[model samples]
Target: MTITTPNNSFNATLQDLIEYPANGINSTVLLKDNNSQYSLFCLAAGTNIDEHTSTRNAVITVIEGSGNLNLEGKDIALTPGVFIFMPANAPHAVQAKENLAFTLALSEHLPAKKGVSQKTIDIVKSTAPVIKQHGKTITTRMYEIMFDTHPEVKSQFDMAAQANGTQHAKLATAVYSYATHIDDLESLKAMVDKIAHRHVATHVLPEQYPIVGECLLKAIKDVLGDAATEEVMTAWAEAYQALAGVFINREQQIYQNAS
Candidate 1:
């Protein structure tokens, strides 16, 4: 069963929602949204759920009865109050040693909060001309630094594009565009959507955003030297995080849709 409220909030007793079928299992979706799914499960004695894998991370809390959970080849006894966390794609199976009831919460990794201060927007916009002039150099240096420091991520990039300088040039243009439209982000919706799709296709993870941001900031400081003042660097860092937040959120939505 599903519950919908006008305010998008509700509270219900888990025991009231549970229904144990004789020699079978029952599941009720308590809530579901883009980021998460909350469900209540009831299993009759002798019931067994075959091993399986899930695309989203999950947590299980045993509310009543007894069971055994085999997670990634490890057997975990499940009794009242037992809680288990299962990472995405980990194989798991469940058997009811007695009539069992549990709560399963599945969720995707959420992106960091996103918002750029007005001061940061102004600073980034004011530096557009300078960034435009040295954008290519900074981006090229950024890729070099990133590859040198985080060699594991090298496979995600297109070596051919990097060798031909096309990738850096493209990033330079994107940087300039962002600076020009800092205050009018709606104008760059198409470009942002295109890049977000490309990032999802390339399997970019939210954790990698900080790595790229670090490398890009270092490259900016190296290329601009004294021109990259403390304030400027700080503003750019904030701007990059805000931009990364956008990409992370969009990519997450795409992943949720695909799943």
Candidate 2:
């Protein structure tokens, strides 16, 4: 059975999502409308949820059995009809003494930020296949546009190396590496650090980033042509900004430390 709201979203019953003896620790979402979410959790005896925190305020309604909920380093008794209100970012955990069931309701709260968002991650991931196919061409085009349009910025280039095509090849490899590892940036820390150091040595300035970004994005549009729709271009722009943030932040620190 379904209960549809005016917005076309529907309500879900907990019983419909799970049963007693879910046999182990089990959970299912009952509703997810905008900033509100509902989840059902069932745990067997001796089962537990380790400590964690939420970025949104949450409510827990115990439906059956008994448990001890550890909240902010303190344990609280939990039984049928017991309700727990947890403020955003609170550390909590649960342990089941017997078969236990509960409903978790999360209320709207300020959207919390940690790092680059999931949307951007997906956008970058979607481009990985296309990037893999045209990475070298895109980078080579980016250099041509950059050098041709901004000849004054050519002091940073090694003309002989660019002519030999090694520079474009290196830039292409770096761009592809970043696209593949966008989700796990920590893995690229050493390489990012090396790039930052080289940029600092080469007198790369913050103001010049936009120029490179424009050329690179246009180059992508040129190389991929019809495949680089506005959405794809927008996503690549965001990805570039995210990576530029990393590079710029590090370069700032390097410049500061040197001074």
> Which candidate's TM-score is highest?
1
Clash pairs (backbone) in predicted model 1? none
- Candidate 1 — which residues are off by over 4 angstroms? 1-114
Once fitted onto the true fold, the runs of candidate 2 whose alpha carbons sit more than 4 angstroms away are: 1-114
Looking at candidate 2, what is the lDDT of residue 6? 38
Model 1: ten consecutive residues of lowest lDDT: 1-10
Model 2, range 85-105, lDDT digits (tens) per residue? 998657788999988889998
List per-prediction Cα lDDT, in the order shown: 0.86, 0.79
lDDT of 1 by residue, 25-102 (tens): 998888876667788999999899987666457999999999999999999999999999998657799999999999
Using lDDT as the measure, which candidate wins? 1
